[model samples]
Target: MVEIKFNGQRYAYWQQVHISASVDDLAASVTLAVTRPGTGQRLGVDANTVIEVLIEGTVVTTIRPDSIRRHVDANSHSIDIEARSLGRELIDCQYSQTLSGLSLDEIVKRLCSTFNVPVQVTAKAAVVPDFSLQCESPANALINAARAANLLLYATPDGGLLLTEPSSAAPVATLVYGEHIESYTVVDEYKLRYSDYLVKGYDYRNDLALKGAVKDSGITFFRPLHIMADKTGQGVGGCDRRATTERNRRQARANRIDLEVVGWTHAGGVWDINSQVRVIIPDEDIDGVYLIGDRAFTLDDQRGSMTRLSVMKREAFLGDPAPGKAKRGAKHKAKSQDERLIYATDLE
Candidate 1:
């Protein structure tokens, strides 16, 4: 009853994981990926392992040593697996398996009766997930068809899947799939533009450049600086998951990253930056924080339109007003030398 599969852990979607197991007298460890349902994530799992088998809802049986299907694609072409024997070949069907509330014969007959599809019946024990169990019995016709020939059920991270035997110890009749993903990935993403709220197209870039420059300035800023989302020209929550470029861009401060429920968007100018994102990688120097490996590039929402979202880079933080400086533009009216220089130059 001892096992080892990614240490017996599950991942969501597709994860490239390593799993090994020793059940009964069989021992195996190989590399294979866990794949998502449809074009599912490719998680790494070893097909060579002889996982212990659980009947009904209990891990009462040990899979015999040869009860596994293992193969490699031919040197160049493909090698289809011929139905080989697993464990001891059932010369006479040692154990009679009856699917209560379900009959493969009836299901196949009904499918042929209704859809004209003669589903080839391969009577076998469970192997892979296939349908949404919570779906009503009325859906059995279309539902069973979606099932894997072996009938292994997979669940979403959020939604739980029920097992045929809800009481088994080993992964019972169901497997819960979620963030425990075999591996993390960034498939696709959209950068929601807040152009409707933009002050000006180019102005946005200018402001961003300035802010970026200020942020990039190497001076040691105090720890835990709380900057409001206002005046920054940055829409709250708009900055969190956008595809980012390799060039330095300040990460939203722990205190500054906003997750506002409601925000603004561009009527037409949207941006989508497709990129690769790794789950998380730790900074050797930093203990708990991780530097994300999210490769990114800028893309226009309005691919054909002339409009584009503005991105600006700024240098030197604009902070702390001059202590005794006169109000801007006061030189001609009434002021001092400093006032003339400060207010008169770059009036815009």
Candidate 2:
């Protein structure tokens, strides 16, 4: 069950609820609709009210409402509330800071503290010689810095920031078609893919030029993409890592698997982002391990309770070695044996 608490009140019932979390975004988003006064005897929920959300007696996120709408009819009264995690402050606020010789975690902690957003660093990274932020969004700065360090920076479920790398552990669970999966979609997008990815940079301090290049074996054509390494990624090693990251991200996204499963909890715990899961769908020939990049817990009259999962190849965020060449053989062979089918319902 889902619970929303505000001003020391617990609202155990809701007409509709949708909560979305993703590795690519810095804040988790929530939309709730309910009849009656969920906020005690109050007529309506106040703007910018701090709310704590819990699922199955476990704290998930603390959110502040960005919008609240009320509706009344002849027999029914309801309110729709939209909220986001406290980490939204980092995305919405501008910050200016200049620091030298600090690690990625230190830079993130400093910026996050300015907005009173708590931070946790789970990965260790090298120190950047210099860093600067000129009235920029802290979210962007943190994201770029983490990318340079080959890490990820996203909002935690508890309304704080987390800096970490993708998990290399075992799959949390296996999702099988016709069992746990309610629906599925396989998307093949070539627009984002390129035959060659070239990353170029210059290290001003060392007066040296750096270059890194990688190819998309699937593209086969002569399409190429050129990228300029940012200030953080200014060295030869940094440029190479950036190039590999770009290619892996594009390839993973170019072919995505979206699934809708019944209920919210897996065997071990609640559905989570940045975790790995094994997928088995014989007809689609998609029997492989994947990374859960996005998750959404949704409930309504039509769909009582369900979770939406968007998964990509594990190498997308892990930055694994030479991504996909050695592991995709069996899956590729199976895919070649059959023509792909269009899941029309997924479009809507």
Candidate 3:
């Protein structure tokens, strides 16, 4: 979640070292190289503006522009720069177990037990939606390939990800990613993104109480239930630049998963960005969102990218996040729970 969205900028963080090393280790720092496409106007960075750096799910340290240091040679090809750690702590993780079942929340509590957490648990639930099939692995796998790293860890016991120690808890300090949908209160309407004012992003590092602590995966963009935008200002907005177009232009790509631009809420209102966003793959006989079952699609907000699979069938997920049947008499006490918790957090 700690990204440097600057124009033609190359930065190396001297703060926050999340790598394995020892007093006997020779290297003094860990670094990251970042480069942009050179066109947009970058504003959040400055020569004196110092930002925090997070390494391997850990916040190592913060360094100044001078201390971090930077050099731009005659080569225009260096799209990425490296951010190295200074006098940071050696990073290590231990496996802990909890009979209550572990999750991100438990992880942070154990890590920062000494501090009073500044995080506003907008809401917490030991339960995750059953997801009849399973929380999609291809989805998280797609993300792993999409974003250079597994920035958002998938923890649904899908046999895909490495679950944290047995401590039986979710992330205590995390950069959650998710949409902030707000037009409707239905499950299908859950794409509420920060751009729609349906989602809220917070930078917990600014709060002394939450410093160096994994606030909550709720802030991180994941399923319709979890979020962590509040911890790292990683809220995804509506105005994000989509890459599917470029990705589509390439050779013989079809089948598997489909991608499309359906509709989006905009300016003082809601509207569709494209008139006809059909699911289609090229060359192969298959077309029209055939790969991802014509249902899964990602929002533009960088912070919230993991769009957890909806229990609703592909056809049900067609139009939008709006629910179909009236649930008052159908099944679980969903209506009452929605009324109770939606107001507390995800609800706009």
Candidate 4:
């Protein structure tokens, strides 16, 4: 069940509502359709009206209408409302500053306070000195700072912000393909693969000279792809760390196989973005742990309720050496076998 509240009144006359939330740097949004008020009716609302969305008795989001449309015909009249989470305010609020010797958590907290947005930081990141940035908005600054620390910042269901390390929590539930999954689709992309990473930084002590390459290796084939990265403001150790982190990220994304599944269980209330989940699929020979990267919650009187999940490998969330390898042995073997067969045939 869904409820919309406006002007100190609760409304349950909505025909349908859809809520989408994701961990992939997207703002949670709500779309609802309600019966239009009749002539001389006291109910009044507009695009600027602040509203709250309640799902199954829990306050899911606080938003203001981004757009409102009215549908009128001989048969009926209805109003469609679209709203975005309060986090959108951060994006709209521009900021400019330079701070030295502040950690990622401190920066996020300060920014959130400035914008009057509540924040919760689950994990702390390494502190850096002499950080400087100029962004058009506070959101952009926070995002870039989080990226440097390998963290993620997103809006929570209750209109608060969350800054945390992905895949740091344990799985809340296990999903079996034949049991809870109603339908699913898988996508595997590997066209952009790299085996070596070269990260260059500046040596401040040596009169701002460009530092040498910091290399890291990963699994690859076909001409040993090389990737270059600039860590201009970072130190030598920071550059090395950045190279390793980027290499792990690239390798994980290159060999990534994502799954989109519609399941029977109610995952919205139980799981959030970056939540770990154990998945088993016998037919696809897949049995591993994954992270919930994206999710959509839907409920209707006729169709019942369902949750759609975008599951990605742990590497996508935790980078590398944390969850180790995902289920890619079979696919790798098949590709290698095909290559060997082609070479043998040519020789014969």
Candidate 5:
């Protein structure tokens, strides 16, 4: 069941609820449509109010209202509320600072602290000799630093920040189509991939130019992507690592599975991002363990309750190629279209 609470009171008679979250994004969102409320139960929700969202008695997230719409007519009265996690501050605020000789963890904690946001770094990241920012969004600075270190930075359930790696443990649940999943869509778009990825940058400290190049062996034709590296891509072999990271992320995104499940809670608890799950779609010949990158929980009169999940290969986050299973299609030379595609590697 879904519940919304504020000011030590649980709201009742909400007609619809929708919550969206992602591991790649720093903010989780909630939208609610409330029906008629008795006198003195108007909720008194406003922009200053903070809402606690719970599923099956477990707290999922906390949100601050970004928008609220009230509808009233002679016959009916209703309210629509939209809110987002506290991390929204980082995305909205800008800062100018030139940080030097700090680890990625330290840099992130420092920036988050500016907005009174708590942070927890669970992954291992190297200390950089120098880092700088000028009129930059704290979100952008945090994202770049984390990406360069191959780490993940997202909002915790309590609206704090968590810097970590993808979970490497066991699969949280095994979801089979027609059982746990109500519907699914397989996405395969080759245009997102390229034959070559070349990243170029400059090392201002040494007054030298840097270049890093990687390739996607899946593309039989000639397609190349050239990227001008940012400040984070200036150190030794930084451009090369950036190029490889780009390739892996794109390859993983090129092929994904979007699933709509029946409920919001899994065996353990609420559906979470960055957790691995086993997916089995017999008709599509897709049987693999995937990482949940995005999720949305929705409830309404029509659908009752459901959760939509967007998942991709786990190797995508690990700086490795995630070769997909062969799809039924016209052959490309000796290999099928899917078989020809490999992770971000320079192999024939």
Candidate 6:
């Protein structure tokens, strides 16, 4: 059973509800409809009202209403409410700054502190120099900073933030193609795959230009042509190890396929974002393990209840590759001291 609390009050007049949660975007949302109150009563909920949804005695999400709508007909009246998880707060808050010589953990911790938000970190990350950016919002800045170190930052339902590596848990459930699956769709997205990457960075102290490239020969000739360029920030050391680490991270992310499958199973509270599961499709000769990236749970009078899952290959979330010890003796010529007083050119 599902229950809802609106503004510290309990309500039980909902006719139907739909909930969607995802790890890829780090967000959860709900849409619910309730019958209008009788003769002398009025609905007391409005946009931005806080709401908590519980399923089977467990809190599913703590959200705020994004929109509210009312409908009136000859026989009855009803109101519809839509809400999103607390992570929306981060998106709503804007922040700007340039951080130098800070670890990924420190940067996220400071950002959360500035916003008075709660945070929990479970994994370790490398320290780099000079992360500078003007983001559209605080949430964007946090996400981009984390991604640079191959980490993920997402919000919990109870208004807390989680920074960690992707989970490596065992499968919670299994689904067979002709047995439990109602429908399924597979997307190869071959064009997005890349076989080689060219990474470039500069070491200001040594006045040296660093360039590195990596190629994966695993891909057959049928799809052989692909390359990408990457620019590393100032803090990344100008060494082969750093460039190799960046290349491996990029390749792993690009080696993915998009898949969505619908099944008639009670996976609502049992399965969640970042969980691993086994998917078997005998007819298509496809049977492999995958990570649940997104999920949608729906309940109604006619359709009863069903679960839909969006999944990706498990290798996509592997840990970052190691960056070996820095190289020595690399040097370059410095600019002449006599040219120190260069003047800026003005445009006419």
User: What are the models' TM-scores?
Assistant: 0.15, 0.85, 0.21, 0.74, 0.87, 0.73
Residue lDDT tens for model 4, 99-191: 667777886787677766778898787664544445455665565445445667887866668988777567877788768776677654444
For model 2, residues 76-150, the per-residue Cα lDDT tens digits are 677787899989988887766777787778877887888888789898777766666666676766665566556
Off by over 4 Å in 3: 1-80, 83-279, 285-348
Query: For residues 4-43, what per-residue lDDT tens digits would candidate 1 score against the true structure?
Result: 2233652232122222221111111222222222322222
Error of 5 at 189 (Å): 2.4
Q: Over the stretch 1-348, how does candidate 3's per-residue lDDT look in tens digits? A: 333322444334322212222111111232343433334333345454433443222333343232333334454222322332221111111222221233233432332232221111222213211111122222221121111111122211111122121121221211111222211111222232211112222222231111111122222553232221121112111001011111121111221232222222222222111112222223333233211111222233342222211111122111112211111112223234322211111111
Q: Compose the digit string of candidate 5's lDDT tens values, residues 1-348.
A: 777788888875567988888876788888888767432235588777878888877778888889888777666677888888889888776667766777778878887887877788897677755666666567765665566567778877787789998877788899999999999999898888999988655544544455678889999789999876666534312666677777887887888899999989888888899899999999998898999988999989998889999999877865423211111223234234422311111111
The segments of candidate 4 whose C-alpha lies over 4 angstroms from its true place after superposition are 34-49, 191-237, 243-268, 299-304, 319-348
Model 3 earns a TM-score of: 0.21
The order of the candidates by TM-score, greatest first, is 5, 2, 4, 6, 3, 1
Instruction: Judge candidate 1 at residue 200 and give its lDDT.
Output: 14
Q: How much is 163 displaced in model 6, in angstroms? A: 1.4
Clashes of 1: 42
Per-residue lDDT tens digits of candidate 6, residues 1-348? 567787667766467878777654444788887665442234576665667787665677777788877877666678787887767766775555667678777877877777666678887766756554454466655554454455667756555577887767777777787676766876554454446544444455466555555555554444332211112222333234333434444454454434334422346454466777788878777777877766776767776666777777655543235443333335655365621211111101
Top-scoring candidate (TM-score):
5
Candidate 5 vs candidate 6: the TM-score winner is 5
> How accurate locally, in lDDT, is each candidate?
0.20, 0.74, 0.22, 0.59, 0.75, 0.59
lDDT of 6: 0.59
- Name the lDDT of candidate 2: 0.74
- Clash tally, candidates in order: 42, 0, 67, 0, 1, 0
Give me the displacement of residue 324 in model 5, in angstroms. Answer: 26
Lowest lDDT block of 10, candidate 1: 339-348
